[model samples]
Every structure is written in C-alpha cells, then in structure tokens.
Target: MIKVAFVFGFRNENWLGGINYYRNLISAIKSLPDRKIDPVILIGTRGSEDLLRDFPQLEVVKTTLLDRRHPSWFFRKLLYRISGRDIVFEKFLIKNGVSVLSHHHPLGKRARVPVMGWIPDFQHKHLPELFSEIELKSRDKWYGEIASQCSRIIVSSDHARKDLEKYFQVEARRISVLKFVVDYPKDLDLLDRAALEEKFSFEGGYFHLPNQFWQHKNHEIVVDALKILKDKGQKVVVLATGNTVDYRKKDHFNWLCKKIEEAGVADGFRILGVVSYGDLVSLMVHSAAVINPSRFEGWSTTVEEAKTLDKPVILSRIEVHQEQAPKNALYFDPKNASELADCISKALLCDTRGKGGGFPLNDLAVSNNFAQRIAFANEFQEAVLAAAYPQEKVHSPML
Candidate 1:
C-alpha cells in the first residue's frame, strides 16, 4: 500500500480553490487499483467535521499550524528540525514505502519522502498589485524554495505550468497540469431559474459574476463596464457574488465599495455577500452568463466551473482562460470595458448550448472522468510512492 499524505494544515474553507482541489484528489484516490495506498490528510483548525459528511470515505488527521508569532514557535521549529518530529510522516512513508504531498508550502525541509507539490496559480507574480507588498516578496521566495525541493510540480492549467517555467524557472517537463476537475453531481435537478431570481430579488436582467473582488480579478473594470451598458440604456443587473468581507487586514474591501459607489451603478450592481457552496453552484447554473474578470490566473476555477456547469462564460482574454476554457467562451480585453461591453452583447445574443449546471464532466474533465479520475489518482500516487523508496520496493516482491 502506497501511503500518501495530503497536507491540509491551513484553513481550507476560506481558500475555496485549495479546498476543492484536495477534496477531489483524496476522494478520487480512495477508489484506486491498490487500496493499500493509504492516504492521510493533515489539516488545521479551519476545516469542519462537515467535510466528512461531504466525503465520508476520506481519512483525515488534524493538527494545528505552529504559531510563528508565538514565543514557543521558534523553539518548536528548532525541536521539529533536530528531533525530526516527522515521526508520523516517517512511519507512514516507510511502512507504506512511499508518500506524496498534494500541496505547495512544505511544512518542513524533510524530503526523504517524495512529494508532488501543487501550485494552483501564479497571480501574485503576474499581477503584483493584487497582493500586499510583503506578501508578493514572501511568496516568490517560498515558491522558489518549494519548487527546488519537490520531486515534481502539479499545476491546474497549462497556463500556470508555463508561468512556473518562466518565473520559477522550473523545467517545463517537470510540471504537469491535471486540469481542474469538477464535482458536479450526476443527478442535477437544476433549480427553477425563475424561482432563484425571485428568491434573490434578481428578477431584473442580472449578470451573475462569482469571483473574489481582488484587484487582479478586475471587478472594478467590470463594474465600470456595466456603467457603460447602463448609459446605453441597458438595464443589466450585475449580480456579483463574493466575500467583500474585511478578510484583508487592509482597507481594500472599503476601496472596492467606494469604487462601486463612485460608479453610481450601485442600483445596477448588487454584491451578494458570501453565498454557500451549493448556492454558489446554483447561482452559476442559473445565471444568464457567468463572467470572469480576472486579469491573471493560474487557471480560473470560476471559468472552469462555469464551463463544466455548461453555461456560457464571458472571461478576460487572459492566457489562463484561453488555455483552459472551451473555445466558445466569449473573450474580452482584460483592461478595456468597451471590449468587454462588446463581449457582453455578443454573449447575450448567443444561444445556450450546454446542459445547465453540473461539471461539464462530459466535455472538459480531461483525464478525470468518474472512473478514469479514480484510476489516474492511483497511478499518480504510485509514481510518487515508488520514487520515495526505490530501495525497499525492489526488495519486496509484492511491491
């Protein structure tokens, strides 16, 4: 059994992309060729016991992230280094003869166990303003170190894989993109679009955009573009769904609100504060056209999820979207709203062709079709497990 330990030691729910990626991976790995490959998930205080309800088969081990600011943190790190507190990791790796990690930030420098690190996006490097000054510098340094130490790098899209090659300078061949997998249920009873509109007070012609209100997300540009649409006598209700909550220690959220107020399109633009996962999915499905305004992305899960949901997406003409989205998605200049307005018009005129709501698991799932996803999970883990302990595996016939 290849013992694979996926790290989830951070608060995952808040970071939606990471949460979905790890969840899909662990679930897929559970039904592999060799059930012997035991997968242990290491998580921190963030995730809920509800995750088990979401995916009952997954095995998880909970632990908290060390407080770097705490007085004991420095000493704990030191003790962790010398005493090699990788006891749990070591036992699992040695006993199973291999272990693989599914996240990027290494908890420590122990590389005796082979790791396949996942770098979801390189947004901070491409669009520096989206991140705080200190954060950009810290991320670049950390990614460089993480890239150097890992056995292989996994990315969500070809766009990100190329970014890693350019900025991180990792070999092109070392990076692989599994493509973002969609978790749309097979039996999707899409809600009545009319009913959702009534419930959410979106009876008017509303444009549903579910993206974080980051500068890189280019939310300001979209709101401004909607202004143009309104000026032209187009009463488009731009129903945006995202957490504009004050998560950032900075006043960026306040600035975003200010931008909306400045546009004077507050009446046309409604920022539906954070919605639940299921509701978010339904929002994407029911919307007239899902819009992605991100200036940069490793791969836009919003776009991917929208594509899988089989809804038309009007996304920024960025490399990430071009690389992953089905060619039919309407593209617009990331910086220019006139171009975006043109796209919005064209998108509205276009007919809906795909089944509404559910990962177009049929079209863009790549290698992760239901059965193939499970099969690929085992293959991916076995490669890592075999690489981790090349010596023992050769001695054991069963291996």
Candidate 2:
C-alpha cells in the first residue's frame, strides 16, 4: 500500500468549491485498494475546526500563518521563507513512506516526496484583476515554481492545460486534463420531483447559479439579465446562493442586493445565505436551468451536475465551460450584459429536462480518470521508493 497526501490551504465548510473539491477527490482517492494513504489536509487556524470535525479521514495540520485576504497572505508568504512546517510535513510523509499528490499550492514546492501538483486554472495570468495584486504575483511565483518542481501536474480542463503549457512552460505530457463531475446528482433523486418541491418549499420557475459572489463569477451580469426579464414582463426569479461573509466580497453582494431592489425585481431574486446539501440539490432540480456567467473557469462542476440531472444549461461562452458543458446548452458572452440578457430570454423559451445520465456516473470527473487516478497514485508511490532507496529493486505498490 502506498500513502499519498491531499494538501490544501484554508477553506470554509460552507464554501462549495473548496470543500466539494476535497470531498470528491478524497472519496475517489481512498477507494484505491490496499493503499496506505495519509491525506494530509492543511488549513488556516481560523478554518481548521470545521473541516477537522467534518472530515474524520484527514490527517489535519493547522497553521495560523495564512490570512484569506487579498494578495497579502502573510502566513503563506512566510511559508516560502520558513520551510520547517513543510519539512516537518515531509518528515511525516517520509516516515510513513507516502507520496504527495496535491490539490493545491506550496506543498509540492516544499515536498521531498514525489509531488503531483493540482492547478485549477491559470486565471491569475489571464485575468489579473480578479486576484488582488499581491495575490497574483505571489500565486504566479509559487505555482510556476511548483509546476516545474512536481513530478506531474493536474488541471481540471484542457483550457487550463493549454494556459499552463503556454505561461508556466510545463510540458503538455506532464499535465493531465480531468473534467469535474458531482458525485450525488443522480442519488439526489430524493423523492419524486413533486415531493422534493413540497418538502423544500420551493415554488419553482427560478434559475440556480450556485457560485459564490466573486467578481469573476459575473453575478452582476446575471442581475442585469434579471432586470431585462422583469422589463419584458417575465416573472423570472434567480436564486443566488453562496457564502455571504467573505471579508472582501460582502460589499459587492450588498451592492448587488441594492441593484435588485432598485430594478424592482427584489421580489423575484433571493440571495440565500448558506444552504444544506439536500436543499441545494432540490434547488438544482426545481430550477429551469443552471446559469453560470463565470469570466473564467478551469472547469465548472455546477454545469456538470446540472448535466448529470439531464437539466439544460445557460452559460457564458468561455472555453473551459464549453469544454465540460453539453453541446446543447444556451450560450452567452461572459462580459456583455446585452448578450447575457438575450441568452436568458432564449433559455426561458426552452424546456428543462431531468432525465438520468451515463453509467457509474458518480466517478472521478475532476483531476483524474477513475481507474487511472488509482494507477498513477501507485506509480507515484514507486517514484518515492526509488528516490528513497536507490539500491534495492523497486517493487509495485499495487500488490
């Protein structure tokens, strides 16, 4: 059995993106047979308790060093300078004879074990403003260095791989493209659809955009389209769901709320704070379409989940979204409000389908193929052994 670590930074339990990524990846990785894996999960002092309590499988390592603010994560910067924490983490991995396959940053750069780095997207290089100036520089430097140092790199979409190859200069062969899919969209066949709507108290005729109110998510454009729909006498409601307490993002959300009120569509749009996993699934099923207006994405699980439910999608015409989305989705330009409004109008004209999807549909859709992720993990184990004990003949970890 070969051990592997799942290294990540700070995350909120309620945040869908970070937590879901970890949960799905862990679920898949742990399925590897006879594997001795220590999914070494790292989080900030502030965010540690929630994940630790929730995920009993992880080997949690807490650090107060990184702040989840703009470009100035002083703790993370200190990570590069004070290598002891990583060294200690490394010692733990080395002692356990584990390989490290990272979901994110800093771990791969500091790793003595063979590191498989996960690069979600190269959006920092493409759109600098979404990230604070300090964050852009720091992330670029750190990720670029780690991409070069790690044994292999994983990206969620082909667009990301292209971007990494072009900007980070990593060879194409080193980067593997994996599309992300949600685990339980099918199992979310809760009760009959009518029963779910009644249980969740959902009235229907709404759309779901299950992304946080980040600037790049292009939520304002969504709001703009809502306004146009109201003017056209269309009774459309947009149920916006995400974390409301982000340190830097509260004001934007507040402003968006004010915009909704001013546009007289306040009654139509609901900004739900945080919701349970079941309610979220209910929201997806009842909604007409899953709308994503992201300025950029490595790959979006929202649309993927929507597809698995056989629901139609109305999305921004971004390369990454196009890569994962079905060919029949209603498309719009991410930046232009007029284009988005037109797409919304078009989507309203269509029918929403909720048919079942492909076989064993709940498999690894992100960062790996199902069986290959297991195979590569064993290969990673072998790499670490060959590095550690050069003289002995290398034995397969699969046995």
Candidate 3:
C-alpha cells in the first residue's frame, strides 16, 4: 500500500472545514474496494485528542517538529532558513515510511519525499478587500512556491485550477483537480431531529445557513433577504450555525447582528454559534433547505453535505457553485437581496421534512454515497501516483 501522510496543524475550531476535509478524504480512501492506499495523519503534541479519536482507523504520528509552540519547531525553521532545507521534517517522513505528503505547505525543492500541495482556493486573489496586505503577500508567496516547487499541485475545483493558471502562470498539466466528497455517518437515523429542534427552541420548517461568519461569506445578503420577506408580512426563520468570530474581521459577527437588528428581522434570524458535528448534520437534514450565500468558495462542503442527504440547496451563483451543479439548487446573485428572498420563498414552499423526519436510509441513497466515495478515492489515488511517479504518465479521470 502507498502510505500518504496528511498534515494536521490546525488547532482552532474555526478550521472545522479543514478538519472535516481530511477526515472525509481518509474515510473515502479506506472504503475503496482494493484499498491500495494507506492514509496516515501527522499531528503535533498540541493537536486535539478529539481529532485523534475521530480517525481511530489510521496511524497517527505525534512529533514536536509540528508543534509551533515547541522549541523544536523553531529550531527546524531556523535550520530551514539557514540551509534552505527541511531536514527534520523530511527525516520524520522518511522514518515513518511516507511515500507522499498531501495537502500541506510545500517542503522546498530539495525535500526527499514526493509532495502534493493543495491550494483550496484563490479567494485572496478574487476577494482582496477581505484580506490584509500582509495576508495577501503571504498567500501569493506560498501559492507561488507550491506551484514551482511541488511535484504536483491539487486544487479543489476547476475554478481554482483556472485561477492557478491565470495568476501563477502554472502549466495545466502540473495541476490536478480533486473535488472532495462528504461522508455522512451511517447512524444518522439515530439523531432525534425533534429533540434537537426542541433543544434549540425553534419551531417547524426553517432555512439553514451554516457558513462561517467570514466577510466573503456574504451574510449581509441573508439579513437583507430576511428583512425583505418580513416586509411582505412573511416570517421566515433562518437558523445560522458556525463559529461566530472571523479572525481577519474581528467585528464581523457583531456587525451582522447589528444589521439584523437594524433591519427588524432579528426575530427571524437565529444565530446558533459553533454546534457539535452531529447537531449540525441533524439541523441540516431537518431544515427546509440549505443556503450558501458565499461570494467565493473553493468547493463548498455545505453544498456537498446537502447533496449527499438529498436535501435542496439555495446557493449563490458563483462559478464554483455552478460547477458543483447540485440536484435541487436555486441560484441567486449574492449581492441581490430581492433575488435571494425570492429563492428562499420558493424553497419554503417545498416540503423536505420527510427526508429528515425519521432519517430513513433507502437503498438508492446508500448506493449513491458508495459510488461517490469510490470516485473520490480513485481520483485522489491517481493524483498521489502521478506525484510519486513523475516520469510515468498517470491519466486522471477528472482531467
């Protein structure tokens, strides 16, 4: 089996999407019929034990070199700066028998193992106003290095692949598009939707907006849409769940609250900040429809989750969202509140409660999920093989 190492350096709750991506990817690989790849997680001493518990099936190697707070991490950085080589990290991967490193920062050109660098999106390039000058420079530098140094580069969407080609001038052959898939729990039927609704103190059908409170997420449009609905004497409840804070925009959450209050739709807009994974899934399953009003995305996890559950989605008309092409999605301009309000109105008329009422798992749903997992694993494995064996021509089905 080809052992591929996934680096887990994120410790903050705000990066729940990142954590879920790795978990779902590993689970997909393990589900393959032949199972030619063995996925391992490389975490730090400061990493969450909960994260370790989430991946009990995989081998986890904890090392001080990954922990930013540890002195060894600083020493490694100094050594890299002095010699332009990541000797400690390279040695760690070699000792652990890692054939390829995926989805981590590029380890310079001189690294021993094959590295597959992942650039989720070019959000900084498109939404430059949301980022500071320092962040813009850092992303450009990092992405540029990944394009030039890494043996293979993985982008989440073709939209991102275009961005990489346009902005970084990288050859199309060097980039691989691997759209990640969601792996829902098998025991979803055990989650009591009614009890969760009672716990959160909400009534009947509601729309779910589960994106983080980042400025680029464009939550102001949702607030405005709620006000438009209220003006028409229609009360629509939107249950928003995510981390309330955006480190880049410290006051973004408060600003959104103020906007909701000013629009007099505070009664209809409920912010349930940072819910547990099970509760989040239950809420999505039980909602009238899932909504993603983001102005930009690499590949939307919310859209994928809603699709896997056969739930309808009301999404913004972004290029990536169009590429995703969910089954029952209503697209609206992210900047137009009236358009989103119309989409929400139409979504409210559809009755999706039955899908989540008892969480029944039909044969069709199981088959579709199995097929999606296999496709994701096959594409990811192809990317790994291409990176590991650069001389051999590995044809990706995605390309």
Candidate 4:
C-alpha cells in the first residue's frame, strides 16, 4: 500500500479552518476504494489531541516535532537539516512504512521523500496592512522556498494556483487545485431546526456569520452594515460565531465590540464566541442565511458548508469567492456597507416567508458533489503513488 503521512501541527488559535479542511479531507479519503492507499495523521501532544477526537478511527502518531515551539524544537530542526530528516521522526515513519509526507509546511531539503506542501493563500501579499513587517517577510520567504522545494504544491482554488504561478513563478503543472469538499452525515435533515435554535439561544430569523474574527475576515464591515440598517429604521439581527481573537491585532475583536456599542447597534449584532462543531452546524441550520464578507480567501469553508446544506449565503465578491460560485450565494462589494446592508435586508425578507429555505433537499446533488471531490482526491493519490514508484502504473478506477 502507498502510505502517505498527513502532518497536523496547527497552532491552537481561534481559527478552525485548517482543522476543518483536513478533517473533511480525511473523511473523503477514507471513503475511497479500499486497499488503494493508507493515510495516517501525525500530531503533537498539546493542542492537536482535542481537535482529532472526532477522528477516533484514524491512525494517529504522536510526536514532539509536530509542536514547532516545543523546547527541543531548535535541536530537532537542526537534526533535520544535518541529515535531511529528523532521526526519531524518520525512524517512526520507516517503522510504520510511510512513503510520502504531506504537510502544511515545507519539508527539509535533505529528505529523499517526496512532499506535497500546502500554501493556502497569498493573503499577506494581497492584504499587506493586516500583517506586520516581520510576518510579511516570513510569509514571502517561506512560500518561495516551499514552491521551489516541494515535489508538488496543493492549493484550494484555481485563483490561488494562478497567484502561486504569477508571484512565486511556480509552474502551473506543479500546483494542484484541490477544492475542499464538505462531508455531512446522511441524516443531516433529521436535525430539528427548532431544537437547534433553542439550544444556541438564537432566534429563527437571524443572519449567521460563522467566521473567525480575523481582521481580513472583515467583521467590521458587517457591523458597519448593521449600523446602516439601524439608521434606516430597519432592525436586523446578526448572530456571529467564531474565535474572538485576532493574533495580528490582538485587540481587534475588542475594537469591533467598541464600534458596535458606539454605533448604538449592540442589540442588532450578537457575538457568540467559539462553539462546538455540533452547535456551529446547529446555528447554520437554523439561521435566516449564512454570510461571509471576507476580503480574501483561498477557498471558503463557510461557502462549502452552506452549499452542502443547500442554504443561502451572502458573500463578498472577492476573486476566490467568485471562483467558488456557491449554488445559493448572493454577492456584494466588501467595501460598500450599503451593498451588504441591502443584501442582508433582502435575504431576511425572502427567508422570513419560507421562500429560500423551503427547497427540498437533493441527495443526488450532494452525492454528485461528493463524488467529484473523491475523484480529485484519487487524482492526488495517483500523483503520490507515481512519485513513490515511478515504474508502476498506479492509476485506479474513478469513483
């Protein structure tokens, strides 16, 4: 079997996009035809254990290097460079028969194994103001080195693939646009909308903004739009849920709250901080519509989740969001609060009368979308197999 190790070493921060992306990926890969490939997740001791609880059936390997900030990280990084691989990590992989390493960061140049590096987006280049000078330099250097070193790079959207080629001069063929796939349970319809609303203390007719409070996510614009609505004597309630911290601007969330209070629209906007996966989905299922007003995205998990559930979404007209083209999405300019205010007002009006939310669930559409995702995953697996054993034809049948 072709054994590919997926390393999960994300920092325990407010953002859940990285975790959600890999979770869906693991789920989709597991559903592929049996005996084609074996996937293993390598994680650290600290922040990763709780995140992977949903994946109890997955094969997990715990290690220290997964924590980049660990006390011994310096020594381990030096060891990797000295020998092209960490001795302990190499041994663990060999004992488990691992052939390839797929991680969010670039692997050491000395390692003989083929790596699939993931660069989610070039947001720092696009929105430089959101990052400090040190972070800007780090992002440029890290992405450039990874593009030059990795056997192949994985991006979430074709827009990202184009950006990689244009800015980093990475070859188009070297990049794979593996758009994310949402893997919802078959019994999603069985969820009681009323119970979900009651559990979250949310009314049935509130717009949902289920995005982290990252600066670039443009939460401020949503609040500004609510101010516009309030001025016009239109009271629209927006329920926002996500991590309430922004590492770049530590006080960004506090600033947003202050703005809401100053605008005298605190009652119109609700901030529901970090919630469980079940509660998050419950909020979505019962909301009037989901909204994403981000200035940039590689591929939005919010849009994917809305599409899977056949719910309405109001998204900012960024290039990547436009590329995603969610089925039931309405677009608006991110900078214009009036445009978004118009969108929210209209969506709520349409949603209140059961016009947009009454569409019958189409199981075939969901299954077809999922099949396309599995096919893409299979193509990626084929590439990994070719790198591991170039002499053999490892192309498996389509799903």
Please list the C-alpha lDDT of all candidates, in the order they appear: 0.66, 0.65, 0.86, 0.79
Number of colliding residue pairs in model 1: 2
Q: For candidate 4, lDDT tens digit of each residue in 1-399? A: 778998887657456888888877777777787547778988776645777755526788877666677866667777778776566565667777888877545556655567788899899888999899999999998998789888778888888888899999997767777887877644334336666556656554688899999889999888899999999998888889899888898999889999999988888789888877766776776677899999999899989888877788999999988888878788999999999999998888778653234332477866776786687667667667765665676677786
**Which consecutive 10 residues in model 4 have the weakest lDDT in total?**
352-361
User: Model 3: residues >4 Å from true position, as ranges?
Assistant: 188-190, 352-360, 394-399
lDDT of 3 by residue, 1-399 (tens): 889999888787777788788878888888877756789888898788685445438788899999885899999999889888788898889999999999877777778898999999999999899899999999999999899898889999999999999998999888889999898755444357668777899777788899989899899999999999999998899899998889998998899899989999888999999988888888887788899999999999999888888888999999999999999999999999999999998887676453333453467977888888889988888889888888997654531
TM-score of each: 0.81, 0.76, 0.96, 0.91
Q: Report the lDDT tens digits of candidate 2 across residue range 300-395.
A: 878766765666688999887788757559888887877877776676666444321222234444333445446645554444444334466575
Once fitted onto the true fold, the runs of candidate 4 whose alpha carbons sit more than 4 angstroms away are 11-13, 67-74, 81-88, 185-191, 354-362, 390-394
lDDT of 2: 0.65
Worst 10 residues of 3 by lDDT: 352-361
Better of 2 and 3 by TM-score: 3
lDDT over C-alpha atoms for residue 59 of model 2:
67
> Which has the higher lDDT value, candidate number 1 or candidate number 4?
4
- Candidate 1: segments with Cα more than 4 A from true spot: 31-38, 45-47, 51-53, 64-76, 80-98, 107-110, 185-190, 245-249, 351-379, 382-399
Error of 3 at 303 (Å): 0.2
